[model samples]
Target: MRTVRIWAEHSPFDLKDELKKRGYRWSSGDEGRPKGWYVDIDEALEADEVRYLSEHIYRRDVDLFTQIITPFERYSVRA
Candidate 1:
C-alpha cells in the first residue's frame, strides 16, 4: 500500500467528493488534529489515480501537515 498526506485550512470534507470521484479511500486521523485525514491508495492504483489525488486534495493557501509513511511505521500521539 502507498500513503499520501493531504492538508487544507478548511474542512477536510471539502475534498470528499473529489476523493470519491477519483476512487481513493481515506480514514480520519486520531485525536488532537482531527481536521486532517489520511488517504490510502492501493498499490495497484493507476497513475491517473495518483495524479488526480495529488492535484485535487489540497487547497492552495493552507499549510498541509502531511507525511508519506508506511503502514508499519509507528507514530506517537501527543496529549
Candidate 2:
C-alpha cells in the first residue's frame, strides 16, 4: 500500500476554519511533518481531493507529498 498526502503549505489564516470544517488537520510540525493543514487519503481520491482543495487553495499555497520511503518527495498540481 502507498500513502498519498496533500498539504496546504503557508495556508492563509482565513481558510483555517473552512479547512477544519472540511477535515484538514493542522500539524504543529512534529514527527517530521510540515507545519500546515493536510489530509491523508488514498490515491484514488486525488481527483476529488484536488477539486475540493482547489476551491480554497491557490497554486502558491499547495505542497503535495507522497510517502514511498523516508524523506517525502514533493509533487505539484495547479491547485
Candidate 3:
C-alpha cells in the first residue's frame, strides 16, 4: 500500500497533544526537513487526513495548497 507523509511549513504547536494522540511523531529537522510533527497514513486516507489537518492548523478558515514532495507524499502550505 502507498503511504503519504504529511506535514506543514510551521509546526502547529497548539495541536501537539491532539496530533500525538492521533499517532503523529516529532521530526527533528532531519535531512533538511523542518522541525515538526508528522504522520504517515495510507494514501487512501488522504482526503480525510487533509480535511482534519486543515481544520485545526493555523489560519484554519482558509484554503491550503499541497506541494508534492514525492509520488506518495507532500508538504502543506497555507493559502
Candidate 4:
C-alpha cells in the first residue's frame, strides 16, 4: 500500500470525520516525538479514494492549518 507521511502541523480540522469517510484510521505512533500531529496515507484505500482523502480532503485542510496550531494537533484514532 502506498503511504503518505503527513506532518503533524499539516492536519485538517475535520480530520476525524474525513478519515472516517474513507475507512482508514490515523496515528502519530510517536511521530515527531509529540511536537505535533502526524497521519499516514495507507495503500489499503482504493486508488480513487486516496486522492479524495489526501489531495481534496487532507491536503486541502492542511493548507489551511498553516495559520492554526491546536486545531492541527487534535485528532481521534481507532483503538
Candidate 5:
C-alpha cells in the first residue's frame, strides 16, 4: 500500500486538509498511534503508479511512510 503521512510543526489539522486538496485521504494512524494522522491509498498500486505518485505529488514537511493496515483497521478509520 502506498501511504503518506502529512503533519506540521504547527497546525497538524491544516496540513491534513492540504493533503486532502492534493487527493490524499486522511486518517489517524493504526491502533497504537491514535494521534498520528495520515493519508493513504487503501488499494495496492502498480509499480508505475507508485513511481508516478511519489514523483509527481508535491510534498511539504511531512512524514511519508508505508502504512500496514488490516481490513479491520481500514474499516475503523474515518474516511
Candidate 6:
C-alpha cells in the first residue's frame, strides 16, 4: 500500500468529499487542524495520477512523502 500526505486550506470535511470524488479514501487523522489532511492509495494507482489530482483537481496543497509519516510534530493521526 502507498500513502500520500496532503495539505488543504479548506476544512477537513470539504477536503474529504473532494478526495472521495477522486477515488481515494480519507484515513482518519488529526482533525483539529483547519487545513491539513491525509489519504491512502493503493500501490497500483499511478503516482502521476495521484500527483495531478492532488495538485490540480483537488487543488489542495500537499507534500509528497514516500513514507506514511505525518508532517506536523504536534498533530497525530487518530486511530
- In Å, residue 44's CA in model 1 sits off its true spot by 16
By lDDT, the candidates rank as 2, 3, 6, 1, 4, 5
Positional deviation of 56 in candidate 1, in angstroms? 4.9
lDDT of 3 by residue, 1-79 (tens): 5676777546467768888888888889877766777777787887787788777766464333333346423444534
How well is each residue in 27-69 modelled by candidate 6, as lDDT tens digits? 3444553334444444555476556756765566454533343
In model 6, the worst 10-residue window by lDDT is 65-74
What is the C-alpha local distance difference test score of candidate 3?
Answer: 0.67
- The per-prediction CA RMSD against the true structure, in angstroms, equals 5.9, 8.6, 7.5, 10.4, 6.3, 6.9
Give per-residue lDDT, candidate 6, residue 70: 38
Over 1-79, each residue of candidate 5 has an lDDT whose tens digit, in order, gives: 4343332222345455654675555345464553443445544553433454345443333334454656666577575
Model 3 misplacement above 4 A? 59-79
Q: Estimate each model's TM-score.
A: 0.38, 0.64, 0.66, 0.33, 0.35, 0.34
The candidate maximizing TM-score is 3
Of 1 and 2, the candidate ranking higher by lDDT: 2
Candidate 1 segments exceeding 4 Å error: 1-3, 12-15, 23-33, 41-59, 74-79
Better of 2 and 4 by lDDT: 2
User: Could you tell me the lDDT of residue 8 within candidate 3?
Assistant: 53
Ranked by TM-score from best down, the candidates are: 3, 2, 1, 5, 6, 4
Q: Between which residue pairs do clashes occur in model 3? A: none
Candidate 2's TM-score: 0.64
Listed per model in order, the count of residue pairs whose N, CA or C atoms clash below 3 Å is 0, 0, 0, 1, 0, 0
